[model samples]
Target chain A: MTQYTAVHGEKVSLLRVLGPGHVWALGVGIVLVGEYMGWNFAVGKGGALAALIACWAAGMLYTCVAMIDSEVTSTVAAAGGQYAQAKHIVGPLMAFNVGLFLVFAYTMLEAANAITLGYLVQTVGGMAGFADTHDKPFIVLTIMFLAFLNYRGVYATLTFNLVITAIAFVAILILFAAVSPWTDNVLKPHELLNGLPYGWLGVLAAMHFGMWYYLGIEGTTQAAEEVRSPARALPLGTMTGIITLLIAATMTWYICSGLMPWEYLGQAVTPLFDAARLTGSTPLMVLLFVGTIFSTLASANGCINDASRAWFSMGRDRYLPQVFGAVHPKYRTPFRSIVFLVPVALVFAYFAPLDQVITFSILSGLLEYTFMAFNVLMFRKMWPLGTIKRGYVHPFHPLPAFVLLALCATTYFAVFLGYGTQLVAMMVFYIIASVWFAGHRYKFVKRGAQFTMPWPRPVGH
Target chain B: MENLNNFQLLEYAAWGISALLGLWMLTDMIRTNRAHSEETLLSSKEGEIEDSLVIDPPHQGGHL
Candidate 1:
């Protein structure tokens, strides 16, 4: 407690203003958009039951992620998430690549959310008899609005996220209740269930899309610097967040699959909105309409927050540029990094088609997940158990790491099966970026200063 | 421009506002860079320090 107070007396930085609830909001908010739209692409690959299997399988993968992250982040206690982990446990090049993965993955997700918001607005305009409305302005405005929330401060941004995320989660429950699968209601799972139209291979293929269900829950660690008690808050918020998303994901699949045919549900742009429409209830449709809009906004807002933190940490260590490391004096936010990534996200949002935007985001996320498994193994082997105090330590030893690696490999293969060209292209982009960073950026980083966390020396050396 | 409908005009308004906000953020960032020294703004020593709540593991050896 004395040490905590001592550290706060003299630094200009991100405010220690977040709690467990903010952590939950940040994690869940980024992911709840999948419940509204993106996860149905799994249904496209497999049938309904296969998609459900993919959902739980993907859920198992993220569960391992949340566990491994809790242990490392609780001890590492830095803002860069896996980037910081790599810096300490892995090497400079891997840390640099992990940084790029976090930045691109979240930035692309932000773009996807912005794109979805634009389309949803145009959809509303179409229904209101404005036939020729453009989506570009709406896209730009959505990004700008969330950017303002993030720029102003962390507390307001996440609190707003909490409200919108709760509304979106509840809209799914409301749709579930209105349909009332318990009684004889609108859901017809018996009639609508298609038995693995693409067969077992389809279930394997669907695993990648199943990831959309709880994609960014591990992002809770990015707020490590902001949390008042990271050990308690990080695990509490993250564990609860995973539970919320699993329930929301299962309910979303059940309702959408029961309400609409698996064939149509696979391709629907706004599946939750479409599910409400299928029930012939105007009120439910209105609720879902607003729910979809809010979820996208919340997601984009959370992405900006996480992406900027990863970039800012790298910049602070001179991994990018010192300019982006500057924190705003009054707001105590990473103002420069937040502003720098705006146009990058904006370009991708404004130009890329939404599905392509989402595919890019998922592939990037899968790559980041691959890094986590190796990271924990290195940390445990180098530091060993009880070498340094941990805020929270994950149980089950190396089992989680092994499980995470196997799942990540399977998902990578699944992604390759569906998107071989895009997968290769994204890998090429990262390799090119890596070469540039090693030649240009890595030269400037202060190697010793980067090791700021006060821990005993590693076991070997 | 005159051929545009009410909805189209509103669409342009949204774009204009987005541009304004974007410009505002950039200028604010630039202003911030000038108002503070690089070290002052970048000094985030606390960010690297483990919060006291995360105690070191029971020791065969103590933490740094």
Candidate 2:
């Protein structure tokens, strides 16, 4: 029998209550705040100017990815985002892998945010020696708290995301205003060119850290199933979100690099704080710190929301156990999956070193990016233009997807040469996922109906 | 311990992700062809059943 309800016997569906603003909030909210910390590490690798170049490239990369993603989501309108799109273009096995990797990426990113939150609290509170053990509780608590926000309902979580996202952006703008007057010498050509210290290779090195500036823009599609009129909302929300991020990224690089040397900025964990301290303004430093906290909270909260949806989608499709597919009767949310992810994230945060976690997260994200580009190519061939109504048609045919795929392939080779162990770990993860999928096929088919690809095409044609 | 540059890491990921995709697509094509052939056979069987029903109707008692 075809299952009419959600898996686990619940007659539940994700409510389509989100609008363009909410979509924008989710998109920007997930990524905008990285300027406060991780992206600065790129400065160390490539000097300031090189890092800036890397950042710009990453922004372009995101813009391209988001544009293609917008087109796909507008048509697919499924809960699992890239995974769902994969189903239309590829086989079920591929879709299962996409969904699993997506969940891993989001959860890992969430854990990174939680760890950063712990560090931020430690810095602001002057908690020396507390990081060795005390940070664990803080990280765990942050995860649980974010999970609660998502479990309440989409309305509550998204409304909170919108409010906090606005405040965070305003805080960044205020920092810009404060730094502008002191930027005469800071913005000089000599200072900007100082980034070439490590030479051209530094530019490549900068990409890893620089990517943090706009890493999660593509994640917006994960919310498509929850959006009202996703075909219309996705493009508007994603385009606006990326443009805003680009502006914010440029302003941040200019001001932060201007105030301090690339080397100094690279070394500072709280780059914004160090920049404010340069002005001899105590108030500005405190305000920037507060903004960092808000941004961290928003990123973690948004990831929890997105990750649970991916997990729930998998469970609903019977790729995993159905228990994870259960929805809250009162809240109309995937409450079980949200609850399940908390401990898993905490374990990762507690055990893994921060840099390793970051590396792993980036790899997982790249996997999704790779396949999304592939899917775009395959989907266009399957449902050629004019066949299906499109929400947003990317003007240039296959160019963006081809470029993204090429970038991903080359970048993977580079990462393997640079960091073999992490590369091996990612490969191991895929191997394990493949094994589990093959073994579980029998159970999946017996317990749940097989999912059909919804895109229309004549089989023989 | 030298840290890998951002671009290199990206390339590394691309390598792994793309390789896996290539492998999966190859298998998917094989599966799709099998399914297509099975569907063709099923459709042919249905047509034969329809022909049998039309060409040979039930006989009336004794007159046959």
Candidate 3:
């Protein structure tokens, strides 16, 4: 028995309609086409062999993050995802930080998708003479269009996710067919061994691009509150999504890299398109183009859905304004937060460079990963064993979390050293969040808000 | 500094916007606190749950 009291006194709560399939769609939709565009940039950083090595490392990292996150979701099962878990496992202030980081990460990723989709449309359609600046009109329209669909309701949003994710899968299979004939001719055995053009350091530098392969798959947790049966569905959906992504990532790497020179693909704005073109098939390029469109649209749409839920959860907890926490009376969706996110995404799409936007998005996600891993350990320490029944538990408690923490720190350090400016920009964003958290603390104390950690105490302790 | 390009300029603008957002949140917090009084703020237990919904130990996996 649960209810919501919006600031305006409107009755609001999220409807539980999503099942395992929709959960899987939400998880995979946000990251289906990583091998399409931004991932090619990794080849530029680390060459073909080094990039593949980086990809394998990132895949393992995502597996750990996903398993640990599945366990956390089983406990909290709240819409705020990591933010909600952090509040229960850690405290309110850390939850606030996680909330803001989640919002920034998802919104930036959405904007990047819109920007790249615009570029793809221009390239695929062969539009001429509009290169004076990035296509602001196209990007803005895409954001508004996705936000509009989101505003309609969650059912429409998830339905769109399911459809497009299927299309993306089919598109990849066709793409494999397009590249298969040429793979034997163009792929060199020597490139496989001697292709570490930038050496070991390049692997570190290329990690962000490697992360593109499975960056947002853990967004499955964000859907915990909306799923029909969180206990059973969350673990199954998320684990299935991870395995699917790993297969897609491996296949995308092999076929795309083998079909064309890794150096050339590295520089390509649209890697799949370049791979299709290499086969010299007009129909194949068009097929891959459709897949690219589906992939970008699904990514942008799912980001809005996930980010708005995070914002809504924070507002419900009084971290943000109560207005942000409000769900639409008729649709039962977080319309205000979803609407607010549209313009912010459009602003980024218009002003920020695409590569910088991608880096910042991944960086913010890594920060959230570090916090989530820490929260896992905190939960174990506080709850101990046999105290609570969990549906899915990762083996060797704390080991996976520890490994994830080390990987996150190393990746952040690499990004700071390689891309200093974006790192600084994110730090400034964190500073602002900290300042707001301080003010929030002042308000909490002034208003005498009750604080409680929702963990059970052992009798002796 | 002399060779600052459009992208650099954009980054500065983004930083400025972030700073402004911080100030706005702080001020909004103060204003909300002033408007509602401690009594009204404490009356709502919107997100708090009655019992601890801690994670249950797995039936299969060994206890931590």
lDDT of 1 by residue, A150-176 (tens): 897788888899899999999999998
Q: Highest DockQ, which number?
A: 1
Candidate 3 ranges with C-alpha deviation above 4 Å: A1-11, A127-134, A181-193, A440-455, A458-461, B1-64
Candidate 1 has a DockQ of 0.25
From the highest DockQ down, the ranking of the candidates is 1, 3, 2
Residue A262 shift from truth in candidate 3, angstroms: 2.3
For residues A211-288, could you state the per-residue lDDT of candidate 2 as single tens digits? 789877887887876776788998999999999899888878877877786657887887876777777878887777
Per-residue C-alpha lDDT of model 3 across residues B1-64, encoded as one tens digit per residue? 8776554444455445544544543454455445443333323232332212211112111111
The per-model lDDT (C-alpha) reads 0.86, 0.72, 0.73
A377 in model 2: Cα distance from truth in Å? 0.2
Please, what are the lDDT tens digits per residue for candidate 3 over residues A1-461? 12222243323356566778888888899998686667777788888777788788888889999999988787677787888888777777788889888898899999999898877655533443333434454566577767767765677688889999888877777777655535466544355444677788888877767888888888888887667678788888899999888888877777777766766778887777677777787888787777888889888888999899898877766787765765553345676688778778978898999878888888889989999788888877777667877768888888888888878877887687678888888888798877877775436422324233344773345
- Show how many residue pairs clash in every candidate, following the order shown: 2, 18, 6
